[model samples]
Target: MSVPVLRGMRWWDIAPVLDLEYELFPEDAWSPGMFWSELAHARGPQATRHYVVAQDPAEGRIVGYAGLAAAGGLGDVQTIAVARDQWGTGLGARLLTDLLQHATAFECDEVLLEVRVDNTRAQKLYERFGFEPIGFRRGYYQPGNIDALVMRLHVHDAQGTGNHG
Candidate 1:
């Protein structure tokens, strides 16, 4: 497998990113308006927010993407998605590592995220990065009405290993 290249997401990348967002998150997919809103945040007062796209070197198209918002000691993983075809190809891990690196660069003491209750795969990914379940939000998701698991990761410890949990 070719190594995936990571890059800062540009305005032009939003369309393709939105396509994958819909593909990976059919039921709760964010609309174009929402992605635009997030992009604006990425360029606004929250300029520290990191939004990135991952591409397969061979194809040059976006295969995955991730977002993170860092303010002082707190970080939040806004979202993460991988093309359905690349689900188990480790692209998600690459996107996650990039987010964590960005969080660390921003000097974030901890990173937090909310994962759908049924998304154990994502939970495992977060767990692998030192995130632990801290709480739950009842009826956090709409339509299906699934709950959300709130997870947090502390990145201030001395041992800054790449993989923690």
Candidate 2:
């Protein structure tokens, strides 16, 4: 299999991204309007959002996508998803690394995210990236009434000398 390529997500990629999004998170997939709103702030010099998609070079299909929003020296991971077949392939890590890099570029001192409490796979991935659980949101995921684990990571400064915290 060819290595997937990672590139800034464009408006045209939403359809495929939504397909993957629904496939991975059928019960809580983001609506088209939500994606549109995120993409709206992804461009321009004053952009506060960064979104990216991973495409299979051989098939030219979107296999993964991730988004981040930064403001007030903080970054929040909006979403991250990888195709079932792509699981255990480090695609999630790559997507997250991209988001963290963008967070640093946005001058964010910390990054935050919420993951389904039942998603141990994703939790382990976040832990591998130095994230630590700080709290939980009860019944955060609707329709299923699943809790969410809130995690945070302290980003290193531009000089890479130490964490921004």
Candidate with the greatest lDDT versus the true structure:
2
List pairs with backbone clashes in candidate 2.
none
- Candidate 2 has its poorest 10 consecutive residues by lDDT at 156-165
Model 1 per-residue lDDT tens digits across residues 1-165: 577789988889888888888778888887888777777767755477889999888988798999998887899999998887787887888888888888888889899999998998888887877788999999877777889999998877523665633
lDDT of 1 at 111: 90
Write model 2 residue lDDT over 1-165, tens digit each, in one string. Answer: 778899999999999999998888889889999999999999999999999999999999999999999999999999999999998888998898899999999999999999999999999988878889999999989888999999998886333533322
Best by TM-score: 2
Query: Which pairs of residues collide in model 1?
Result: none
Q: Compared to the true structure, candidate 2 yields what TM-score?
A: 0.94
